[model samples]
Target: MHTDRVYVVTGGTRGIGAAIAQGLRDDGARVCVLARQPDPAEGVAVDLADPSSVPAAFERVLDRWGRIDGLVNNAGISKVGPSLDYDLADFARILDVNVTSLFACSQAAAKAMAAQGGGSIVSIASMTSFTGQPERAAYIASKHAVLGLTRALANDWGPHGIRVNAVSPGYIRTDLTTDLIARGVLDVDAIEGRMPLRRFGQPSDVVGAVKFLLSAEAGYTTGQALVVDGGWTVNGYFK
Candidate 1:
């Protein structure tokens, strides 16, 4: 369904971002990955934390692909510590990369899409967007901002045919999560038992939802946060 279309995925070097990029390519889209260390063949090196680098990366995509049909804002970072003792710099840096850079990328993509009459943008939000977890004050706040930005952009750019939406995942098992579990930061068994699905989500579990949002099938969808959590957020009863 994505034949010949061009899509850009930020932080596509690994994990969920890489999965989404590969999924898009499998459906025949031309994929460009933006990352700090990108594969020379199919990726563009861009430091999203650097404000000036965002526009230049998009420009490079436009220059190479001629037009961008979709953009996946998947780059994000987090710092875990007691909220009271959290480093101020760490909190600011999280917001800079997750919220600020996301907005910049969306602005760049929206400009290109508006000129071409239409496009889709999907941001990787988090279950934190809806509810807070311990030691994740900054991450939660940034995700909340992402959801708000998605809605605001949809409202502002609807006239220009730009669709903005987000996908919020819960406890997806990626390399990062693996490290967290190994370091005892996360209790994998407890998490799985609490989740209705009784298992952690694989990165591939999110690919389908993301592809749907980016496809023509979702033409009428915008400003929505689709949760791909295996029912983790909805189960209220203790297991």
Candidate 2:
């Protein structure tokens, strides 16, 4: 459906980002993945923690593809610890990679899209964006900021034919979640028991939502957060 379209995916080396990138490619879209250590074939090496690296990466995409039709801001990091003892540096670093660099990438993409007359931007938000979770203050804050920025940019760039949106995934089984589980930061059985779907989400669960947002099917949609959590955020009572 996305034949000939050029898209950029941050953190596309693994997990949700990898799924999204491959999904786009399967649909015939030309994809450029940005990661610290990239796949080399279609990947552009970038460290999202360093905002300065974002522009050049996008520039590389434009140089190669001549235009970018969509951008997925999926790169992020988290530091799990008590908020009271959380190092300020760690907090800042999380924000730098998750929020600041996302905006940097968006700005770069928006500039290119504006020149080309249109584009779509989909960011990977989290369920923590709407709820509070212990030991993830920085991550939660950065996700909240991501949603806010999606709304703000949608309003600001709508006139330029740009559509900005977000996808909020919950309890997905990825390397990040495995680490959280190993560290006792999350309990798999407890989460699955409480989740309405009664299972942990896989990375593939999020691919369809993201692809929809970036396609003409969602042409009229913007500034919205499409939740792919299988009812985790809406459940008012425990299952």
Candidate 3:
């Protein structure tokens, strides 16, 4: 596929997903955004948790666009609280949207990519994937599952010319992270201090990684998770 190939971004309506989708669009790729809300950017209503909706969503992609050159499974939900006091529904809901929906979408995308010669999948994971933090059991578990899904898809689809990988972000300055830090639920200063760069990550800071991983530059890379955390992961996150 060419550099300006088409892409589909789940949860492209907001946050990091929106940033990534805009990056792809800026590269001249035709983008189909699968979101809960409708907008002029061209999106559809699809809840990630429902398995039945997964195939139909992709069908819409095929109907609207000839082929899917890339897929960014960036839609995820998190529930933070002490595990002992966690709401059962919240935990399940987190896993269903973050882990289960990603699996379904990757499967659907792989089928499309495999038939079309090749494609790339970039899953949005989290920094909690490799570290244990308090009151985020569901988020942590789902992110780990995302890494597994990325690797599994790479292993099964690489031979078919499909590449699957993930990007794990740490301490982004999005509304969610800002709110958590503001409420003292997350220690932004401490987290940023651990990074050699010593600052919270910007959404734009991660767009390059996504662009490279999806481009021909990453032709040989598969089954990998790129952590864009400003050295936080490498230093064991300590001063």
Give the best candidate by TM-score: 1
- lDDT computed for candidate 1: 0.93
What ranges in model 1 sit over 4 Å off? Answer: none
**Superposition TM-score, candidate 3 onto the true structure:** 0.94
Write out the backbone clash pairs for model 2. none
State the lDDT of candidate 2 residue by residue for 79-140, as single tens digits.
Answer: 78999999999999999999999999999999999999999999999988999988899999
Error of 2 at 100 (Å): 0.6
Q: Who is ahead in lDDT, 2 or 3? A: 2
Local distance difference test, candidate 3: 0.86
Better of 1 and 2 by TM-score: 1
Candidate 3's residue-wise lDDT over 1-239, tens digit each?
33559888999988898898888888888888987774844876788867568889888888888899999999998766889999999998899889888888888888989999999999999877888888899989999999988888899999999999999998788887888887997887777778899898999977788888999999999999999988887885344
Question: Which parts of model 2 are misplaced by more than 4 Å?
Answer: 178-185
- Sort every candidate by TM-score, greatest first: 1, 2, 3
In model 3, the number of clashes is: 0
Model 1 residue 43 lDDT?
78
